[model samples]
Target chain A: SQQGEEDPQALSIQEGENATMNCSYKTSINNLQWYRQNSGRGLVHLILIRSNEREKHSGRLRVTLDTSKKSSSLLITASRAADTASYFCATITSYGKLTFGQGTILTVHP
Target chain B: DVKVTQSSRYLVKRTGEKVFLECVQDMDHENMFWYRQDPGLGLRLIYFSYDVKMKEKGDIPEGYSVSREKKERFSLILESASTNQTSMYLCASRAGRRALWGQPQHFGDGTRLSIL
Candidate 1:
């Protein structure tokens, strides 16, 4: 069974707007990480929030983790057309395995 | 920069043929993993190796095997290729020892395999 499920299978937003994607996992995890995949490219790590951390920021990206709810959200501020990609949330198990979500397709139209 | 390289961007094989997909990492990462991606199914891990000559089964390991002869290289093998096994295979490597799963993974571009 998949551990993480991403909400909003697809999302469309205009440039300079904010984009938020949510992910919910079904198990206890040490941490949650977000990754982006461009067309025909491999996944690139974006941001990671630890279990004990509530919020983290990296440049225009903000990540919020709610361990109590077993969910996390990634926020991209002032989105651009280059931000168009498939975003996935991954949950790490105790055994060092990562289970990825179905992913959210975000298209930032310029 | 960390770079995980897959041997092929695309591959085609006939059913019942033996197939091998190779991956190499340049960051000297201690962990390597193999996954297959399909539409709506997401990426399902097939196998992972935490060290040289060590391997473990992942979520869906049926009909698949792995070999990690060296620390920087990991290989996934299909004993007998089948049509249903066709998918986009991705290779990832993380710079962590066993049980240190918080680190981010670097991925290869992936190999689109077709089993005819």
Candidate 2:
């Protein structure tokens, strides 16, 4: 069974707009990580936030984690056509295994 | 930079044929993982190894087996490939929690396996 579920299965926006993707998990986790995958390509590491952390930033990407809600969100500011890709959230539990969410497909139009 | 390599980028096998997918990580991380990605399913874990010779089943492990004879290499085996088994296979590696430091996993380019 999948432990995490992402909302807005798909999103579309023009370049320079901001995009937000949300993820919700079912179990407690030690940390949460986000990844980006270009179509038919490998996954690229984006960012990770521990349970104790509330927010993190990497370049134009921002991530927020709310353990009380067991949810997290990824924000991509000033999106570009190159930013179009599928985003996924993975939860690492105490047991040391990662459970991934379905993912969100973001399409940035130029 | 950490590098994780998969043996093949594309593979084609007939039904009932045994298939092997190899992954090697250069960083000598303590953990390695195998996952399969589908159109809508995102990525599902097939197997993982925490240490040399130690393996664990992930969320979807049926019809699959793993081997980890070396600290830097992990192998995923398909006992009998089926059409349904065709998908993109991904390999990843991570150091222990302390070294990982809440960082995302490093992934291989992936193998596109087609079971006919």
lDDT of each: 0.94, 0.91
lDDT by residue (B81-110, candidate 1, tens digit) is: 999999999999997765566888899999
Candidate 1 structure quality by residue, lDDT tens digits, A29-49: 888999999988899999989
Report clash pairs, candidate 2: none
iRMS value of model 1?
A: 1.1
DockQ of each: 0.86, 0.63
- Tens-place lDDT per residue, model 2, B45-108, is 9998888999988889999999999999999999998899999999999885565634567899
Candidate 1 DockQ, CA atoms: 0.86
Standalone chain B TM-score for every prediction: 0.97, 0.95
Runs of candidate 1 exceeding 4 Å displacement = none
- Grade the docking of candidate 1: high
